[model samples]
Target: MLPASTFVLGGAASGKSEWAEKFIESYDLPMIYLATGQIFDDEVAAKVAKHKNRRDGRWETIEEPLDLAPALASLSEKQAVLIDCATMWLTNHMMQDSDLSTEQDALIEALTACRAPWVIVSNEVGQGIVPENALARQFREAQGRLNIALAQQAGLVVQVVAGLPQSLKGRLP
Candidate 1:
């Protein structure tokens, strides 16, 4: 059976989101795609378009770059939500100068409280060399912390690399 939640972690373009989508689809539940990416340039817009094209009528996409509480709260146990992903969500909050600790705590609480099963995708940003800029370094640190918390809360944790998934904490359902 699918667990309450699964944390999918990987580097950029590591096929994490695609793996998560398939994981959620296996359960045959109504799918809710909670998108956190915000388009500020042509590149991002094109990327978002690609993701949209990947989904069919089975998905109900919710575009909320910040504040996922409302959409998460509206889900039921009969549904499954894919929050693809945490990196962009963290970026949005960081750009707004939000309190990282407070926001992270709230997000964890909300995810735990959510009634539906979920697959949350996040980037493994700490694998690369240290960034030179302070902002980049700060983002890497924050993402690492968030990923840790998510892994701890999740019943299953998988790390994707080169389009392959390796289970970390629990067996893949």
Candidate 2:
């Protein structure tokens, strides 16, 4: 049987994505990489390419930048889906002036009823100093809230730092 949901959190360049990928790798099920970033420039494009290359043909990619719940709800249980990030997904909604509460509600509901095992990646942004601007502050707050919600959904929660994972919810199962 597939494993329950997982949440991996870390700071920038803290190996969050790599850690999440490794966690998903341990599962023998077909892999699915649910990407949330939108490539707006050459740098972003290069980063996306690097991630694709690192995945090494093991994962089926689903690029969903704005809508994640529907895509998650549509996955097959045979696939272990890795959402390599919540931050970008949140930014996409914030940029569009979408209601965060509704989006988060849908995400939580979908997460509870997803058709497959899910490994979710998200940045730990509240550990740093407070933001200067109002919008930035709001974003941080929203991210914190989302993390908490995701943690509750996940049977396993881990914080990755310098390529090391510290399990928050349960030991590596």
TM-score of each: 0.98, 0.95
Task: Kindly list the per-residue Cα lDDT of model 1 for residues 33-152, writing each as its tens digit.
Answer: 999999999999999999899899999999999899889999999999999889999999999999998999999999989999999999999979999999999999999999999999
Question: Which ranges in model 1 have alpha carbons more than 4 Å from their true place?
Answer: none
* Cα lDDT computed for each candidate against the true fold: 0.94, 0.89
lDDT of 2 by residue, 1-173 (tens): 33578999999999989878878988888899999999999998998898888887778899999888788888888878999889999999999999999999988888888888999999999999999999999999999999999999888899999999999887776
Q: Tell me, by lDDT, which candidate is best.
A: 1
- Go through the candidates in order and give the C-alpha RMSD of each one to the true structure: 0.6, 1.3
How far out, in Å, is residue 38 in model 1?
A: 0.4
